[model samples]
Target: MNDKMKLKQFFPMLAFASLALAGCGGSVSKTGIELSNLDQKAKPGDNFYQYACGGWIKAHPLTGEYSTYGNFEVLIENNNKQLRDLIEAMAKGQHEAGTLEQKIGDLYNIAMDSVKQNKEGYAPIQADLEAIAAIQDRKEIIAQMAKLGSKGLPGYFGFYIDADIKNSSMNLLQIGQGGLSLGEKEYYLDNDSATVHVRESFKAYMEKMFTLCGSTPEEAKRKMEAVMGIETRIAVPSYSAVQQRDPEANYHKMTYEELKKDYSGIDWDVFFSTMGIQGLKEVSVGQPEPIHEVEKILAETPVEDQKAFMEWKLINSSAPYLSDELRACSFDFYGRVMSGKQQDRPRWKKAVATVEGVLGEGLGEKYVEKYFPAAAKERMVKLVKNLQDALAERIKVQDWMSDETKKVALDKLASFYVKVGYPDKWRDYSGLEIKDDSYWANIVRSNEFDLAYVIDKKLNKPVDRDEWYMTPQTVNAYYNPTTNEICFPAGILQPPFFDMEADDAYNYGAIGVVIGHEMTHGFDDQGRQFDKNGNLTDWWAPGDAERFEARAKVMEDFFSNIEVLPGLKGNGALTLGENLADHGGLMVSYTAFQNAMKEKPLQTEDGFTPEQRFFLAYANLWAGNIRDEEIRVRTKSDPHSLGRWRVDGALPHIDAWYEAFGITEKDSMFVPKEKRVTIW
Candidate 1:
């Protein structure tokens, strides 16, 4: 499974300014969910998103370095400042060898050591460059790819250790279609104005990298074309990002002997041996159709062209860690052209991000000790339970689902494993050696160490159900179908999403809904295919499954029909799972809110009823100012809908939302009862 559902497109940072609360104590609304951010001119029924978030959007415009900015960014910016203080303090303090602090601090110090990095320049990566240049035959190329893959530079395809979908108890080798430089197959295939322009820029980018690698001008041009040609061929075989969403379509188990017989361009024995992977009798190919094409591409392409392609891949992946010129060239295409960011993020921020990536859990242990309190975790537990109960109630009463399916659904819900704040066991970093000598070396070494641990140690072993894909410092949550678990990181347990002292109404609408969102992921269009044991077996009755699919199709069509830009429409089929979670979460959270108020009534404050406040809180969290370029990219790539559509798209489907906002048939966002899609 993938990591947690990311709310924002951009990476999170520290809050720029402390949110102005109404009171001196934590009881104050630090989340900024008041009506001040609303645009009174807009009718709530006609355009609820504009009504709820127009003022905030007007106040905050996109910054030079940010593609999108919103509540998540604000929280991250605040978090980054806290982390920056901790990092800076640790960097200055003395620590023992192999300590988390020492490793963290040394990594930070090396990254900031521009002089050392500049003096060494590309000299640090000379050995890797030489290895790629020395490639002569297919065997050497295959071995080199393995070497690079182990070092975190993926050369040909992707491989990872995941719990076998059919048997969740075992960790198995998963080989999937990868090796493309662009984000998706569409980038290479689509002939839209934007796609064509990006393709041309990417070709130029490859040429620039080849030239920088000391290739003659003509040689660079020819090599770049060859690399692009190879990539395009590979792209032709790969599934679109949307098609990859279907788990059943992708899952294919095979013995090693069977796989070799099916596609025999590269010797599996030699390749696996080179990768240092042993004792593997079988593997699950996520997409065998694309992999079969790899055999054809290898046979048709010359060894020289393949070498050029591999060389480009090596240089392209390592460019960011190299000298200023290479890094700048890399950023020019990926950062500026892709995301429309005119400048680089602050060096300290970048350094902090790098440290977090390598030593996240280690740093996360420190983050929780300093930030997350016992009370917050305790409160979250109750909130999660409330949402679970609400969802269970909805499932029992679902008119379309039969009693047989309901029983299985409840069983799955009962089996749900919830992890809050941090993992029960922390990952040991004592085995990963980090030094202050070289930044690039530390990164490469860390990648190798991680690969070895996963390939040599974790693979072929029993699955660790308690293991988390995200760090405690990550501002996100996830539902893993394979583990039948939902995780809430400490990073998301703050203002906007959750505030310890906020009234129950706001809490239910914000963090409570988020909790439900993740919980609903278990039964989302894709997630529901996996049973309680996290096995890919159908537990639903045939008729009930068909009914659910029919209802799901309505929501899919609704999202697909939405025009994000001229000639650009949202891919409903691609984002179906997320949309399902959104709709289901909203319904269940609203139920949980009603259940909460039955215990004790809350008074209306600032002229908003508790119900209205709940809806407002939910909408305000999605207040975002995004760049047009980012909009174009995310429309084609991201599975989650945009902030505007997250509100406008999902809200129209909820009957309670229309009643709370006094919506009518005349309203632009109005959806009649028959047209509204509700799977839950």
Candidate 2:
């Protein structure tokens, strides 16, 4: 038989024993299988929770959302496989682009295009060291910073660069502000390890820049060392402007006048001018302390690097807007660092990204119509909804949660908004300059454009609700309780995660579960702190809150007990919310499928029933493997569960599993009813 036939035959053989519904590896209740038809059996990787969660493990093989779905990813992948095969057959004797085959085939093509435009795939970028020689004046030295932000590092993106302050633990900083919603940094300190990595990386990267600009090799090395020394001192004073203004702690929220007093070096009028905001005297601020400190430090720097740095910084700060040199600089630095070769991505992907970056999200929407398409979004949306309904049922059954708390929980769940495959509003990149050639210069111009935008926001109103942090092409999804939103970009809609034409079981079990997982995040342990308004509030009664904590504690301790690696205590605290989401998401997705079947009877055209396909779909998601070193590091650092455990941790919570497989006290997944944990 051919590969297709072989794959078709293996479906039932692989799924038969696993259908007891004890967990992810089990079958019978997954797709078309009724709870009544389960055959009590043990399968591969038995006696281990890893196999029980076979579905999840297979789905989240990659770091991104499609593979790392809560449950539905595998189903999506299976669907995609079917579509891929069909498309391939259609293209075997036809042209590449015009034929429908280009749809699936273009995933790599687009990535190649983007990578080529920005990466140094074949060779290093042409950075003119002579530009450093252009600095005849002292101010010219600081002007070099214009080149730095555009070309070298990725520090100022949304993530934090923290410092561990003695006696000042990061408490009270929970919720969105805690990460994005927490109090300002002056409450913390610099010498903290949080700042250590960023400072060192910046210094190292800047030194490379200085070296690249040298006239002689010896001079290059010496200048590089000097630049490193200079950057280190600057970094000691550099703190995140945004972190200081987090609104949750009642931070900055100052007017134009107050902010003006706080950071004198940053021209309030000019910054406001950049962002197109007017009033500043009475508005709220996200951070005041860090902004104040940055101003003080900027004021104190020596005249040479300080002045040029400020000017260069001023220009580079304007994101989505850039000088020609800045844009060229960006392309060079990005193109060089991302790829070993001078170019990596294909031209079309690069064109798309560049167009999306400059033309705004509408262009992306149009691009996706031409490229990503709506069918992918529809598939993802369906799975997400199924999982959501399932979670609602799970919450209804939670014995520990009081009815009042459950009501509020249900309210939050009901209010959850889904944004699958790109945002309605694209970031305004029209202000950004996109010039020809000079990759390094283009990047610098872009930095100036972005920096200006951020500074402008200092005086502007709160974050735009329509604004999306992740690019449309990015393969990731996030649930922001502060915003009460879940965003799924187009990048993650392909392969190994989602497909429009896979077997129902796999598509729903895999990608459907993933959608459910992200949706579940709204009600996760930490996410619960934020009300439906996306503000931090404790609507749950004290008693319910305590009970919820108690349930979460069980989860935390459960993970803490599992040794992912030697001596590495699973940070149950960090992963508690994710684990909860994983558990709740899988349970709900399964139920949703059950509901779907009741309405439609799950008609199976092929040899496989929806039930058989579901388990296979789940397992297929976690089909890939990882390196030991990679696994070890992820265990220590990543908040999400390991690929294997994510499967195990979620599966045992399913009540249907115990019913289907007759799993008893002897089964590792069997938790006494009284000790069972459930939250939705």
Candidate 3:
């Protein structure tokens, strides 16, 4: 659901839902479920995930370049090749200056030019570093931070313009807790061996980066300590992943005057003006406690220490785009130490990712033309409709939810804004200039261009429901509660997820579940707070709301008991929304599969019934090998469960799954019928 894509077992046929009819002719066409992908030695009743996906996991072992390699990474690898070709073609061709093609080609070529990057070393960021060093007062520090923030190097806190939770229509500037380099608060606070190792490696990494940025060893150590001290103080007040999920707790709308009166440590006017934002009225302060802590740190910390932290921020942010040594050093700590990746991605892959980040929609427009088919979009529309109908049917029969709540839930479902394949309006990147400058310089300009777009074009404006957060070429989907929308980009509509030759059972379990998963997000713990119009309002009857929470607690508790790794258990509260979505998706998509079967019943393929194949297809979507380091990292950071748990931990709650594979009470993974989660 984040940004990963999946591609497996390509087929020749271009047909859609009609492909299921191929099984009605007394024989199955290619079911898109490869027999080779199944582990014959494993038993479904004991370990469904291992049985269904063990072969795929064994076949695609984790490589040095990846911490977690899965079906998603396979698709990413394929998409990378496609993107490389497109950018390489543009680089070879002579296009007009200022054109998107020119910008795309120039940016990729600049990023890939290792010789030039190594020659430039840290020279590109030297002026910015010196400017940070020259800051004398708190006002100057705030201004410098804002200047760096505009180029995406946020310091103490970060802000974004998005639909206000309550307002839902007007975009509001929201600032939140930040400044932690290791991301989560647990990494800094945890006494576990793994967390301690990561923290120590990060400290060493900071010192090395400071030394590389022209500091002596002693000076670098001092600066590293200063930055770590400020960050640790910020972390003390920062919200945990679970706590941040509460919309009501996070939202704190305050006027500019109130902000100045309450958090008067820094000059807000200077901060906004430096970022080219003028006459700001009000903003939603997300996590006031952390911001309060940040204010205290800025006021109490010495000027020299503050300057060192700011300079370190600049150096740290610029390291990846700097010389080979800097990039490797950064990766050694982040990629190798934190995530256990043995090597960095290829230069072409890095360059392609950079171009995609800056000019995604511009490149996506061309990508859809070349790779995305009109038929795919048309088929996806039909699939979404079926899933919606299935979810509505389930909603009508929910005994726990009262009639009043059901009516409103149905209304919200009907109001969904579904975007498939691509956006009707492409983003205008004409103003974005890419020049024959240093790679880091071009990246800085790109960041500035993006910030300007958000501030100038979108800030305080009405929310554009049609506007997509992800580009068409991204192999991911998202459900934004403020928009009450679900988007499936063209990049995910390929083999495995949405195979042209797969039967309805396969498609229903794979992409059908994906569609349902997003739809269910609207009814998840967080999304349920927002009503049909996407405003953060309580539309539920008081009794029904209480019952819903009680039911959701069951799901939370169920996942909390699962041991993802040795001694480390899952954080159910942190992953509740996604877990609920996964459960609801199975219920909704399975019903839709049955509805499709009413018209055309699918025959057994590869010695498995339709129901068994459905579950297998669903499990195949999550097949992958992951490093233990990644397991711990994702457990802390990712909202979704790990891949193995997504199948094994989730399927035990599904009633039909037991019937599909004849799972008995004696089975180790079986959940008592009374204890199984009933909420959708």
For residues 1-680, write the lDDT of model 3, one tens digit per residue.
00001000000001111001000001125787887778979989899988999888899988899998887777787788888888999988899999989999989998899999899899999999888888877667788888887777858887777787799888888878778788888988899999999999999999999888799999999999998888889888888878888888888999989998888986888888888888788888888998899888778899889888888778887888999999999999999999999999999989998888779889989898898889989999999999999999999999999998999899999999888989999999988889997888887888888778878866778888988877787766777888888888887788678887778988999989888888888998888989887788999997998999999999999888889899999999988888898888899999999999999998987899999989998999888899999989988977788888889988999999999999999899999999999986
Best by lDDT: 3
Candidate with the larger lDDT of 1 and 3: 3
- Residues 485-538 of candidate 1 have per-residue lDDT tens digits of 888888888877787767888888888878888888888887898999888889
lDDT of 2 by residue, 423-525 (tens): 7754555455444443344544554565556445422234344556455544456676656777777756654455554445556676666677677777666
State which candidate, 1 or 2, has the greater TM-score: 1
The residue pairs found clashing in candidate 1 are: 13-76, 13-77, 14-76, 14-77, 14-78, 14-79, 14-80, 15-77, 15-78
Off by over 4 Å in 3: 1-29
TM-score of 3: 0.96
Regions of model 1 farther than 4 Å from truth: 1-32
Error of 3 at 615 (Å): 0.5
**C-alpha lDDT of all candidate models, in order:** 0.80, 0.46, 0.84
Model 3: lDDT equals: 0.84
Q: Least lDDT summed over 10 consecutive residues: which range in candidate 1? A: 1-10
Could you tell which candidate, 2 or 3, scores higher by lDDT?
3
